[model samples]
Target: MLKVYNTLSKKLEEFKPLEDNLVKIYVCGPTVYDYTHIGHARTYISFDVIVRYLKYKGYNVKYVVNITDIDDKIIRRARELGISPQELARKFEKEFFEDMEALGLLKADYYPRVTDHIEDIIKVVEKLIEKGYAYVVNGNVYYDVTKFPDYGKLSGQTLDQIKAGARIEPDLNKKHPADFALWKKAKEGEPYWNSPWGPGRPGWHIECTVMSMKYLGEQIDIHGGGTDLIFPHHENEIAQSEAYSGKKPFVKYWLHTGYLMIKGEKMSKSLGNIIPVKDFLSKYEPDVLRLLVLSAHYRSPINFTWEKAEQAKSSLERIKRTIERLRRIMTYEKLHIENLSLDEKEVYERVCELRRKFEEAMDEDFNTPKALAEIFEFISYINRKINENKVPGPLARYVHDVLMELLNVFGLLQKFEITGVSAEVKPFIELLVKIRDKARKRKDWETADYIRDELRKLGVILEDTPKGTIWRLSK
Candidate 1:
């Protein structure tokens, strides 16, 4: 049975979806006010791997990631750029998708934006008002924290503790300091929609509660975001969602990814060290980033550095070479009944052993760092077989297929054209790419261009980034 760490319960629990063989997941998405940094990439990539593994285990998954297209950040940035909030949001939203694709992330089933669901949001606020869970002041609506007796269940704090530690904010005419907004009355020069309260927009926490209900239903199997969101964001979400629906548990599992630290400090705008996703891609392969993230447990904070990225790049190259070596060994027909002799029995058993280890690691709270070590162990076994010349055609083919399936579960090796390649051509392609790199480094423009044009004629595409030149078979 698979098990996962539940942030809400603060324990490792066997994963049993609300409905048999189906999982409903909701993750908080970007605000879309600026470019996505690597810190954001870590959260998305962590959840992407979890979703992929759930599907691999024969569960039908419906994942929803919300896009906060309307917010104070969006409004402020839009005004600074002399553009409307809608235009600014749409621009960054497009960029967010592009970065996700470049990182090889599987797209969520629904990317519902807050701007498109205005009617649904207003209706929820109206329902909360009618239910006595919310009150209005000066056309602004706020949820009555006192009404929800279990207000701080998710964050594990009492109302008194929250009120004492909460940030100082402008007096919003709320009943208590812990009370949060559900609807905000419109201010001058900001966008507004018609509502029963007045012309205004949905509050930050209300949009998620509204969208998740409309798309994924009242309660979900999993709800995830960064660890920083646990306090006010997720705590408030749980309180308001359950209160509105009269549901005992708003989410069965509350998951949070740990922070991505830079130089041992948390990434922030004031730090001036936020590295954009696009900038990281320009320096290393997408798989390098994925492997680096998976090298640590999802709930553990990861320190980002250029040296670590270089190590990942080198590690990925070694894996690619191992794959090529397997393919090269398969070119000559060698597997026969006699070839699967007594000596090969242990080899076959080792394959089965590694599969079990991989699954066991993943089952234990999606333990990717342990899972990766299992993969590396299998690779080492294959390398030993290669040196011993005991790898037959049947064994080679089986190993190739299994490795591909395993790598893809982690969203690695998918971007590489690993299948349907002959042993003779791949080596020459690598050689030519290396030659072109040397030529460019020495400012040999003619040689580099000639090689690129020649490769293009043969359906090989070459892209030159600051790191180096990379080639792929043209689609």
Candidate 2:
């Protein structure tokens, strides 16, 4: 059985979806005020792997991530950029999708934007008001935290404790400091929508609550985001959602990805340490970033550093190299498999065993680091088989296919190149390389160098190896 660590319950629980074999998930998405950073990549990639594994296990999932296209951040950024908030949001929203695609993240089934769901937000605020869970002050609506008795259940804090540590804002109209805004009244030159309270926009936390409910229903299977959202944000979500619907558990499972620290420090705009996702992609492969995100367990804080990325890159290369070796051995109809040698039988069994171990690790709270360790062990076994010249003939293909499936679950081995070349041109390049190889064998240095230099100019990089020459499009 697949198990997940529930942030709400604070324990590992068997993953039983509300409907049989169907999971409904809602993850809080980007604000779209700026380009997504590596911090955002870590969170989205972590969840992408989770969703991939769920599908691999034969579960139908409906994933929704809300796009906060209208917010304080967008407003501020628009003012600085000398554009309207909507214009700024549209620009960054497009950029966010590009970065997400570049990072090889699964597209969410629905990316519901706050701007498009104005009616839904207003309806929820109206319901909360009618249910006595919210109040309006000076055209602004705020959720009455005192009315929601179990306000801190998700975050594991009592109202007194929350009020003690909560940031103080000089809002004399608020009955309690723990109370949070559900709708902010419009100010001069700010965007507004018609509401019962007045012309205003929905609050940040309210947008998620409204969007998740409209898209996935009141009780979802999983609600996920960064750990930093566990407090005020998610806590407020649970409180307001349950209060609105009178549901005991708004979400069946609450999953939060741990924070990504940069060079042992938290990445922040003020710190100027934020690494944009596009910038990182320019320097490293998407799989390298995925591996780095997976090296640490999902719930454990991950320290983002060049060292960690290098280790992940090395691990990823090891898998790719092992697969390449397997590909070479699987072909050529190797003569060793006629009688099923002792080592060959052992290799087949070991590969099968590794698959089981990998599944088990994934079952245990999506333990990717341990799952990857199993993959590394299997790679080691394959290398040993290659060294001993005992590659399984047809079984080698099965081994390769299985490893690729597992690696794909982690979003690795995606072919990303700087430029796109047509399929018709590929064979001609390969033919040229082959003819050049023959020339080299005949000691035709000038001809071989000419071919090499010409291919390099065309942006194809070639490396001559003992097994053969391998080529790829240069980045």
Stretches > 4 Å off in candidate 1: 168-172, 331-339, 418-475
Model 2 RMSD in angstroms: 4.3
Per-residue alpha-carbon lDDT of model 2 for 272-361, expressed as tens digits?
899999898898888889989998999899878888888888887677767765664464344454567787778778878988999999
Worst 10 residues of 2 by lDDT: 328-337
TM-score of 2: 0.88
| RMSD vs true structure, all candidates | 7.2, 4.3
RMSD of 1: 7.2
Candidate 1: global Cα-lDDT?
Answer: 0.88
